[model samples]
Target: MLLSDFIREGRKALLALYPAPEAGNLMTRLFSARLGLPPHTPLVHPETEIPPASLDLLQDDLDRLLHGEPLQYVLGAATFCGRDFKVSPAVLIPRPETELLVERALAAIDGAGPGCRVLDLCTGSGCIAWTLMLERPGLCVTAVDLSGEALAEARSQFPDRPAPHFVRADVLTQPRIDGGPFHLIVSNPPYVLERQKAQMRRNVLDYEPEMALFVPDGNPLLFYRAIAGMALTQLLPGGTGIVEINDALGPDTADIFIQAGFSDVSLLPDLSGRDRFIQFQRPF
Candidate 1:
């Protein structure tokens, strides 16, 4: 079949299951991947014949999409900050807004001296950790995730980089792993409330790991609180803490950081201008 025909059909099928922009984006990406084309390349011309195996692969992906699987899981990877990272049902797919957390961390560490230690708690695909290491080669980064499967994926994704000391530890646990006195701590931990589950799309609530998304109904800020407390104890006296927060919970997140004794607490907006990050410094 021609590539355009496949994309049109795929778009139609996905639109039934998702919003137009999401469906269109997923279709375009899947089609590009099948044709061995860069993601931004124009869709293949209608007269161009697609290889049989490619057609079969595209069909399988479309079936997965129709069943509400996240496109990132289907693709087996996601792009974050211009780098590709392996993704799976074991890890929450990295979102573009989460890049704000990385930017804040980068800005905080820009003038810091060499040998600074950084910690990325709940570091799903290691997106934030890897980005930090890439941007600031002088910083030593350790990434922690509770799911062994997610850590395994992160380890495989960055084999060349000094193996990020991956720890299979929960963020809410006491006595964090002994890699700090970290100079900076960053997290995009699970912040979605249980009550908000119904509002999420089927692809996210069904395919993405629940442990990486939903918090207990009454304690939506549980992970934030846990990370903040850990940062207070583990970060250097003048270190920084940067976290990606749900836009709706921005005010509450800022309040939590302040209560945890972080100074210079501030909330920053994402590309969409929604409150997306909380950045603060530990008191000296």
Candidate 2:
């Protein structure tokens, strides 16, 4: 079959499960990748023919998508902060809004000298930590997560550099990892309330790991509270803390940071103007 024909068929199959434009885009990307073609390469040129094995792989991926699997998981990778990172059901898929946390962290340390220490809490897939290290190679980084499977996926993304010290401690019960006295601490921890689970889309609610996305309904700010409390102890005086939080819980998160003694507390919005990030400085 022609590549264009296969894409049209794939889109129809995906639409039966996903009712958004993303369904079609996902199908196109997977189909292109299976064909050994770059996602942006033209599909139908008079000179090229589709490979049989590529068609088989595309068909298999379409079946997975039909069952509500996230396209990123199906593709085994995700793009965050302009870099590709491996992903799996064990880790939460990185979102664009989380980039705000990284941006604020970078801006907070804009003039800092070399050898500054950075910490990324609940660092699933190592997106934030790796991005920061890539942006500022001089900074030393430590990334922590409670899930061994998630940390393993994160480790695979950065094979060349010394592997980040991966700790398997719950952020709420044990927040301190070995490398600290950090100049910057950042997190995009589980802030989604249990009640909010019913409202999430099928692809996310069903495919993404819940441990990385949710907190008990009765205590929605548990992770934030825990991380902030630890930062008060581990962060260097005047160090920065940046977190990506739910828009609905922004005020509460800021209050937690304030209560934990972080000064200059401020909430910032994502590109869509949703209240999403909080940045503050530890008092000297």
Candidate 3:
């Protein structure tokens, strides 16, 4: 089948789930990944034919997308900080907003000296952990996650030896890191309240791991509380902590750090002006 024909049909099928522009974009990315052609290739080379073997693969992936699987999971990878990281049903796909957390953390780290210790709580897909480590080469990062499948995927994000150290630990339980004082702590932990699920789409609820996404409706800030409490002793004096937070609970989430006695507790907004991150520093 011609690439143009496949994209036309794929976008039509996806239109029922996503908007026209988004559906078109998804089809473009799908074609790019599956065929190694640029998104605009089909527009230019409308008659380009796809071989029978490739068509079978595309059909399988298209069916999965139609059934509510996220494109990242279907593609088996996600790009974060310009690096493509492996992803699966085992982990949550990295979102563009989470990049804000990384940016803030990196900015905070600029003043800190080399060889600083970093801890990443609820490190699904290791996107934040690996980004920090790669962006700041000398920082030692220890990342923890409760899901073994997620830990496995996180470990696979980069080179084994030079990569962030991945650990299996429940963030709710205050898992101990042998290294006492981390210079920075970062996370993009579960913040979605069960009640908020209604506002979300079926693709996220069905494809992503529930444990990595949702919290009890009664306590939407559960992970934030846990990470803040853990930071009390684990963060080095003058160390910084940053986390991705639900826009709806920005002030409440900042209160966790404030009440915990961290200095400079503040809520940062994303591009849309939603309160998306909480940043604080351990007292000097």
Candidate 4:
């Protein structure tokens, strides 16, 4: 079958779940990433035939997409902080907004002493951890996650780079993780309230790891409170901690760190201008 015909049908099939533009983009990404064809392949070579083997693979991926599996999980990777990181059902797919946490983290660590340390809590796919270690050389990073499967997925990313020491531990349990006194502590931990799940798409609800994406609605700040408690002892004096937060609880999330004895607690916004992150510092 011709690539153009495949793209037309794929976009139509995906329209049930995604808008036309997004569906088209997904199709473009699928062809480019999976088949190594250019994004404009359908436009430039409309008659290009998809081989039987490649067509079968595309059909399998399409089936998964139609069934509410995220494209990232189907593709087995997600891009975060300008790097593609391995992802699976065991981990949450990285989001673009989480890049803001990494940006702020890099800023906080600027001009730090050699071998600066970072702690990443609930490090699902290790996107933030790997991005920091790669974007800034000579840094020591330790990442923690509860699920062995999630830890395995995080550990498998970027083997050639200086690896963060991935630990299997619950973020809610404050005393377990060591190798801290870190210059920076960052997390994109589970902040989505259970009630908010209704507002989300089926692809995320069904495919992403539930442990990595949600908290009980009655205790919406569960992970933030735990993160704040852990940061109190783990972060060094004057060190920074940042996290991606649910937009609906921006001020409340910031107050968690402030009430935990952290200083300079700040609620920040994402590109959409919704409060999406909180940053705080350990007093010197």
Candidate 5:
């Protein structure tokens, strides 16, 4: 089949599930990934042909998209902080907004010097953990997650680099820090309320790991409280921390850190003008 024909049909099929622009976007991305072409390369090469051997495989991928599978999971990879990271249903696909968390964390580490200790809580897919280590090669990072399946995926992020210390620990419980205090703590833990599930699309609610995405509706700040408690004890003097929060609960989330003794708590907004993160510092 011609690649253009496949794309046209695939986009039409996806229209049943997504709006026109988004449906076109997903097909373009899938074509780019499969054909090793620039996304815009397709418009210029409208007559490109799919090698006969590859048609069935590409069709199977389109069928998956039509059925509500996430594109990242379909591709088995997610681009985060300008690098591709491994992703599976076992972990949440890294979102662009979370890249803000990565940027803030790296900025917090800029002058902290070599061998600074950094910790990542609920290190799904090791996206943040691996981005920090790769972007600034001198930091010693320890990433903890309660899910063994998640840890296994995080460990495989960058095979050639010195990977972060992947540890298994329930972030909700009191965790003993063995490598002394950390200079920075960052997490993008579960903060979605169960009630909000009704607002989400099946591509996320049905396919992504629920354990990594939600908390009880009655107490949506559960993970924040536990993580802040960990940060309070684990951060070194003058240390800093950042965590991604549900945009709607910025102040409530910030209060969790403030009440836990982080005096410099400040909420930061994402590109969309929603309060998306809270940064706090342990006093010197």
Candidate 6:
């Protein structure tokens, strides 16, 4: 079977679940991942024949997509901060927006002395933690997650490089981390309200881990409150704390840090200009 024909048929099949452009993109991604070809190959080499041995595998991947499984989970990888990180149902697939959280955290710690301590709470897939350690190389990072499975996934990334110390502890309940007095504290913890679940698509709602994605609607700022309290004690004087937040709750979330006595509390926007993150600093 030709690559182009596969893409055409796959896209048509996926259209039942996705819009035209997205369906086409999913087909392209499946083709690229399975065949080890560039995404553009299907278009450029329309007549290229797919190996008979590989045809069944490609179809199986497409079937997963049709069943509303996220392509990242099917492939066992998700690209974050320009590197592909391992992902599974055990951890949330890293999102592009969270890259901004890492950028701001790095900027906040720039010019710091070597071995600057950093803490990452609810560190799913360890994307932010690993990226910081890899990009700066001098910082000491400790990351925490509640799920043993999630912690294992985080620890498994970038085997050749040193990983942040991963601890299994419920972020909302843990009072203090052992490695603290950190220069920076960061998290992309659960902020999605349970009520908002209906607004989400099946790919996310059905496939992503609920523990990493939701909170009680009655108290949606639960994780923020806990992180704020942790920062007050764990952060070094004049240290910074940053986190990704649900867009609709920006001001509300910022207030959590402010009321916790963090100075320099600021609500930051993502590239789309939505209130997507909150940053705060411990007073000197």
User: Please, what are the lDDT tens digits per residue for candidate 2 over residues 22-102?
Assistant: 767886678665666766554446345568767677777888988989888999988899988899999998998888788
TM-scores of the models, in the given order? Answer: 0.94, 0.94, 0.97, 0.97, 0.97, 0.98
Compared with the true structure, what per-residue lDDT tens digits does model 3 show for residues 220-242? 98888889888998998998899
* For every candidate, C-alpha RMSD to the true structure in Å: 1.8, 1.7, 1.3, 1.2, 1.0, 0.8
Q: Model 1: per-residue lDDT, tens digit, 1-284?
A: 87667777788888888889888889888877667776544443446666887778888989998998888888898989989899989898999888877887898888888788999999888899888888887778899998899898888887777656788887787657678899999998888888887788777878889888888878888888888889878999989998888888889889998998889999988887899888899999
On lDDT, the leading prediction is: 6
- For candidate 6, write residues 182-210 as lDDT tens digits: 99999999999999988999899999999
Q: Which stretches of candidate 3 lie over 4 Å from their true place?
A: none
Clashing pairs in 4: none
For residue 223, model 6's alpha carbon misses the true position, in angstroms, by 0.7
Ten contiguous residues with the weakest lDDT in model 2: 40-49
**Candidate 4 Cα RMSD after full superposition onto the native fold (Å):** 1.2
Clashes of 3: 0
* Predicted model with the maximum TM-score: 6
Error of 1 at 187 (Å): 0.6
In candidate 6, where is summed lDDT lowest over 10 consecutive residues? 39-48
lDDT of each: 0.85, 0.85, 0.89, 0.88, 0.89, 0.93
Per-residue lDDT for 28-67 in model 5, tens only?
9998998787887658977788888877878889999989
Worst 10 residues of 1 by lDDT: 38-47
Worst 10 residues of 3 by lDDT: 171-180
The collision pairs in model 5 are none
Model 4: per-residue lDDT, tens digit, 106-213?
999998876899999988899898898898888999999889999988898987877999998877865647787888999988888888898988888877888888
